[model samples]
Target: MEKLYNKYEVYNRWLQDSDGYWQEFIEKTAGYIYWAKKPEKIFEWNPPNPFKWFVGGYTNAGYSAVDYKLGRFGDKTAYIYINPEASVERRITYGELYQLVCRISAALRAFGVKKGDTILVYMPNSIEAVAVLLAAARIGAVSSTVFAGFSPKAVADRIELVEPKIIFTQDYSLRRGRRIALKENIDEALKLSTWRPQAVVVKRALGEEKEPPMERGRDMWLEEFLEMGKHGNCTPEFVESNEPLFVLPTSGTTAKPKPVVHVHGGYQVWIVHGALLVYGLSSDDVIFNTSDIGWIVGQSYIVFAPTIMGTTSILFDGAIDYPKPDLFWEIIEKYKPTLIWTSPTAARMLMRLGVSHARRHDLSSVKRVVTAGEVLNPEVWRWLYEEAFQKNVPVIDHWWQTELGGPAIGYYYALVKDMPVGLEFMEIKPGSAGVPLPGVEVEVVDERGNAVSAGQKGTLVLKRPFPGMTPTLWKDHKRYMAEYWERYEGKLVYYTGDAAYIDDEGYVWFGGRADEVIKIAGHRIGTIEVESALLTHPAVAEAAVVGVPDPIRGEAIAAFVVLKPSWRPTEELRKELIEHVRKTFGPIAVFAGLEFVNMLPKTRSGKIMRRVLKRLWTGEPIGDISTIEDEASVEEIREAISRLKVVKVSE
Candidate 1:
């Protein structure tokens, strides 16, 4: 275990020493550029030196992704699109995808969008959405995508922040076998906005005027718009690597959502290097990530990463369990993609559907897979490895955040060739965040400002900047610094808001959030310890552990669990689960109560929104819940809690 990275001691040493860090940074970035594509200028430094990039780059993203492979691999397929209802699919060639992107870039320009202008795109996982994002980059216009499943309020809140002049949306979208009125929601958000965008709506499901437009510049048909730019050429714009390319939003503990800005220069640099290592990507690889372009994973993997590497990317418009539980398997069979990146929540659901769903189709084409967004429970990992893929394919349990643009910690397929069975051998300890990326530095410290030793837990902090880390929260620099930097100011460490520990081997394991740590009788207990123990029960499907205020103990443990189908909760079962926890980690990790539920409140990206639940339990006025992915679940949970009415157990 003696620090797996010590082999590259020279590189790590230079990364820490600031006087020499810039020299090493340039070398690493330059090396990546040369590997990705030999451009006219590898980098350029402008006056004020605010932005740095692949400098005077004479390379087109489209050419790198599509045009370069045209004559040589014109017949190589890029996307294998599957229609959920029809139970059929169509293969799109690399040349064909390139053409669509060019035409769409032309279409966007014909619609009056210009360079440096922002365009709001709200769509699901369709090929057209991917095309539009590339098209925006091709024309130098920034594309701001809103997650299609978000409420109108959520959509409008983002729109109001950026104030884009054009909004791209679809008439309807299909997901999990239901046709959602996407354009209708757009219409509602538009009504609330004082700024009017030239709205272009794709005819996805064949319904018109269901939601009437009340004003001018409100709606234009998708087909008509495409026709307007039919013969136009897509001469890709050469932008500085540090130029702002996309704006993403993250939910705040306070009322509003925080907008995070990422630049094309830094984003491309990291995406190329990170994807290569994380996914073992190659020019011939076909990637299938079941995510929408609205989120970071979709922005990076589904659109940018594969395309930047000049590879094929599969886009699935609906849920993994749409027409059947086998939709993902069906897509893999048809596309033969080499890589599939997704979240564990969906994987767990797929696991519940049983391996029969996978066995029905051919997944032999898949070579590598990744899971992210939230922590992947160890149980899900075992199930995916042994039961689903027959213990053959490697499951990379990636850990990163929206603020950290790419997969900072996970199984590096390129680096770890002989992937280990359990989670530990992949350069990371069981619960640790794993060792920091090549140049990034991580340290765990305590309240009095001192580093904790091995086996002890402390606040997780970043010692240096990586190219992918967000430079600032959009329109809120002070808040951004205060949130991430101020807490450990003089030390130059970025407070991650996460609690973690480093093992003797240098593997980093993440304990839950620092705030989630419960204090009982002068001892601090990580909620993850209790939650993990709770999930060991046969009846428990999933669990969320939180710390609630208590008079005597200062704080106590609360558990919310979603049980297996048809399993009724009883005092007897509850006692059994409590005893199970005691047996696993002793009585110090006891739960206040085991509350049963059908689903946990989560963000659109599958992250549990625990603060909302805390507010609910404490009877705080919930305000502007646009970010809540499951509004109905909040009501259901409240009703269930009222019915239970168990008295608070004291120490």
Candidate 2:
């Protein structure tokens, strides 16, 4: 393993080799993990499901993340919990975190959860909720976490699929100086869901005694739940390598949430290796990944990877804009972390808030910056790197998805490191997502399924399945195959659904999602949800939604709506629709673009061309539309967009 670091070229060769490259690292990294049964085979490749890494291995993700590092790093702060809106701060050590997880694991079994059972964790970004995730993992019970910002309809959609034994939540959450009722939302979700959970474990956010309205038998306080396993002597369940550790919801081709299953063995190995290679994780460093606990970035970077590496991480529990726009900077100054990972949406918002907030704080501790979730525009990148960080550190952008459990492409280390000549890698590219990380093989493919030349734009595809990628969509293998593998004719290549290209020098650049799943402020929003919300409006007859460029949010939900017979489009109507989406989607959807149109442009096949709508809104050239059902419909959209441009200029 040491010898492989001789030349950076050697690592590249391993990636090129692709045969046994990952197995070696997987085996080497497994030595650090606490495995109940060591694997005889490093990997096995079977299509559709695609992989079984560390085959024959029996391990627990929570043990690897917490108990494995307890002896060496127990005294160190594993996480610094801060809720800016609540004005509360606390710290937990690895040993303490391990104890808490043990209690939760026992309570889970008391509540009838077992290996292969699933739980829905719909709580705020608190240490308690994070403990629930680890607790589920400790007992080999799969946990599916939902962003607390989502509405009951969103939660019910996931609940119908998961049919979990327990629904983990809290009394309330604080954000933007408001207390959101989490327990109330859970109750509403239970009403909406067809499948009912056995138990709803509620954490009292106010205090232990300040309880909310609890059901007689179904609801229980987290305190009493922990008391069930108060002995702290619970044994962990060692699930097989392919056993799911957690399920994260991502927007698929339709409105239904696609459960992305990530297993314990490969997931643990990938993040451990990735934390070192990509983010330069070390026991001496503190990392701050600003993604919410619901997202993969937060799960991998903030919780599992950093904790498993025996490093401290800042577990932020509120929005950065809450108390002050400088809340992020304030956290950095107070608790100095060495590495920081956030989304470009957050960076763009901070830029709009002014640099004075950052100037007042100490930022020398952040040696490097990593941004993902969406493409970082060159202007925003330069502003963040030059003006914000003051050119003191490298501002790097990496690329991955909810499907990819870890980063697939990023710099060797965003910070400078001392290594032999062979260990050094390429320089930073402003808009590029760096070179491929150690485990993946990425290529650009033309529509005909041929590999494109360097610098040629085409659909980005993975040549082979990697350890970091999701094993399969949860319970929907057919849809997974059709959506990812069946994109091309019979190549079996993994379609990323992103328009991208590789540079001549081997750097990857993304041109956003080729699919209609638009990302607003780093959260994925299916266009179908936006359209459905619009159609529910009394005055709306039909609607089409697309993502358009937004200075602060990476994209805004641009909706083109056709009105009913008696209802005419008015300024008040537009405002009503905007508020409707925000309320319906529970604050995640920013419906900024509302245009009145007679009809929406659709293809002859009856599919809405969201890309065409996006182009018209962005003023990009409308390419060959011969397949369009009606040319007059497109003309109307063009006129609507022109009026929007005029409104923008006037403002």
Candidate 3:
């Protein structure tokens, strides 16, 4: 079961016959779902359009996630909703959820929703929120779910994209026991939007959750909407496989938002494959993902992937460390999930609180841990794999982007057991993303689109199209071409906008964004290298690095570090950290200054916003703070940088 070389040979064959490889998925999917019409062809290679799969075929993505599992997993628990802030746990079966999807889709169609229409889901992590997505995809309508933590303006920015015919939202969202007025935000967002939707459906709270006053004709209560659509047609729409399933906005530090569109056939094909191949999902396993429906992970892993595979997904609705620092462990002891998918930021958050509270609860239930949303630093991976799980489970680190519908590069955790002899001997690199996924051709290329030598840092580009890879941006085909495909002179190569290097063993190591690399003296350094090195230090709980203009070295590294709760920031500790980086990261890493802060700026999806740090360091105006997870972190980091106007270096 460990033939690593044999697996490589299998992967090479898959690359040789890419379309035939996806045909295998088509055959497997056909057994579960009833396709309205069989596809005339398996695929068509054309860019600047949706990734074509099952060309000329008709199927509904939602049907695969819900309908197909009805007979087989009808009474089985499809989802478990756990909200610690509200102190609630609710399990919904396929039959019960099927009814909701029927009623909701009926309601949507009754309220003038139809094929090709777009709707916005501005709600928290709950069964109803995910149901709305399923219902939308069940029909031909496209649904876009926004993060609950986004501001009114941020929501409005996405609202302006499709001018959704209907917005599915909630009365309020509970976060760390704090009430966020979601309905009020939607009302304000509608005013900012130019297109007027026919109706806004609001799902109220549970237990003492009185229905809020509606805006007359503009808003409809969830119960009332369900009643209205009760008699409407609930039959799944016969949508072409290549039709747009949903649109997810890019929430990075970009100057403007580019909503990425995912189609029915290609999206489902890869999400289902990745959930099984990448994460090893099955009906016997329970996956607890600490992500929200606002991002791609939430849509694919939390909602689509598990249900499509007839597995139970633990839907976490509130903060990971909220109510108590040991909330994650409490859930683990209670539910005994087989797999845990989370972010490096969340893991570091728990790691910062120390293990005293975690040790009190049993963590033996987890079989594997997977991390993304930034490179999983070796320090965090080792802690989770060794100290937390006692090295009983593998802490896997995979890489992907929102533009990619599913995982592009990941180790085959689910299929690894069946791998041939040499495969088990393939040692896991704690820091590197395993390898290019099936039928995905990845290479580190220089500026001119030529492959670079192994271990040499360069741009990461996909030489050809993969099923799950985004065909184009939501409505801006020209901009999509300019942003991703045009960077390499419009040669059809997908520019990942990431700086990475593939080792001789074929593992991908992502340093950071291409724009985030720092030039010191005559050497270039990725900020991730400095941050990862800092994380290895005992006192450093979380660290973020950015390059600032330096008179002496062109660019120098400035680090913002958050020490563990037991450790306090001091001049002596700061000097020691500088020396530690000098020794570990080598003297090539020229330090401009190191600032101790209580927190680091991050997006709602848990990605550190290093650009904000660079802006704050130079006394420049930080742009577009809408997606900031914690606003206080920005101000705190800003104040710390004000005292660091004079660069201190060379310990």
Candidate 4:
């Protein structure tokens, strides 16, 4: 069949008739996979709440992602694993990966895992971790992963929610040459929770110091777990389209994290379609997704997306700048990936190391660089294009949330039937998150559910549900309806809770979170706008802005900034930064308070925890911070706030 639609046609159709466009898109992408039973309908939507896709289809995500590619590309490399030091490298071909996934699936089934069962994976990015997730999908079981660095309480809380049949983890994770005890954290978490699930431990570091003792009946070694599966025959379980595939917990900064659920057929379709259209991947390409498997990006791209496309994916289990600032560049030099997807915070962190480190390696193999976790500041975007990638590659910044499950608004690297060979990525706007993807319908609407005019900021909402969008929060359909659907009462819209505006050219621009927008003197300002303006200054490396209570203005803008290598924190520099914001964005952008700190508190995925900063300033109780990268960074901000108080008293 001829390619269904090109980039321009798809966008125009989406704008003209979104419902028709999405139905056709879903039908077209379905041809790429093998289905045990076809769907009865493309989608079914209740009046103002429930939405589902691929209503009656039956498919196995693991079979489609791993086993289906074996006949055509069995010998093709599936995964390329690299260590932090670039010393050890391993590659797993499609056929080999299939066997491993089968063994793991058999093991899970042997341990009494059945369809509809939930399994919790708490490990770093490794072959075992990926196999465990696919194994769960192979058996029609739901899997959820918590970041390896999460605290015992964080893990226990998630475990309490899902109550998985088995929990998979590794003995330890190596970060920056330091060994983090993963199994110990799991043990601690098990103690806190009342549920007793079987623990499957992968000995990643055997004979390195003393290994933790496994409990008699509760814990089993990975090898032994696989051995039990060797005696049993394992086959992929083709499940209904809407069957729960995985439950991913949201990384909300302030509120308790909720589990967002995605299904088999819809999620598989979206991953294959989105990876091809957004990241521009083919079976011949290699992808290096610099995200841990715990985050949504990692769950989608690092594991299922690339593998489903039968492409080589690089799984790096290390820090970006460990041992040397050029670690990422060095990996690129070794692996020569065509597409590199990472977080914006990583880009800023690399920017702080200067371009000299990146220049030392030959990055000619890289065609495109994409970032998504948070908004990409214009300064960092420019630096990435000009300095790091040398103005040759396109730096694509896309936008999506954990709830959406995939890219909702971004450039699509569409290749129509007429032009199938060679790479053809969409145009890249410097700061905007590009246009909506082929099947997604995005709109900026006012409080009354009316579409806002172009260039007017409003709440970002999805007019129609796409295949990749999460069905609902796990076991909490009411919360899902209230949080997303009920907000725009009487209208079937998915409120994103993000303040955004569409430009005259049809590109979507994000203006921070709606709740995070600061209202001062009857004027509303986006925290991202102020943070972006501050980043334009030469000495500033990173900045996080928040709103603090103000008697006169109701809420005032407060900024926390991290300086460049040579610049030191001083009252003069702070004043100059405040003045710089005023000059760049007018008086409204001037911060009521600005503090220079060594580092901003961030999640493991590199998102700045602005809520933590706000709470520290206002003396509010800071909630669970187990996912924070550095607890000391919060202390640094606290000390800066203390100094501000001392200055206030002196004044």
TM-score of each: 0.73, 0.94, 0.79, 0.79
Give the poorly placed runs of model 4, Cα more than 4 Å off. 1-7, 14-32, 47-49, 253-255, 416-426, 447-450, 487-489, 516-651
Q: Rate the local accuracy (lDDT) of all candidates.
A: 0.67, 0.81, 0.79, 0.79
Q: Model 3: how large is the Cα RMSD against the reference?
A: 11.3
Clashing pairs in 4: none
Each prediction's RMSD to truth: 12.0, 3.2, 11.3, 11.4
1 or 2, which is superior by lDDT? 2
lDDT of 3 by residue, 231-333 (tens): 7899888788888999987643342467888988778878876776678777788899988898888998988888888889899998777898888899999
lDDT (Cα, tens digit) per residue for candidate 2, span 499-581:
99988777889998888888888899888877887777899888998878877888877788999999988898888888777
For candidate 1, the lDDT comes to: 0.67
What's the residue-level lDDT of 234 in candidate 1?
Answer: 68
Which runs in model 2 stand beyond 4 Å of their true positions? 1-7, 16-19, 199-211, 231-233, 414-422, 487-490, 647-651
lDDT of model 4 at position 310 = 80
Off by over 4 Å in 3: 1-7, 29-34, 46-51, 198-213, 252-254, 416-425, 487-490, 515-651
Q: Highest TM-score among the candidates is held by which one?
A: 2
Residue 418, model 4, lDDT: 25
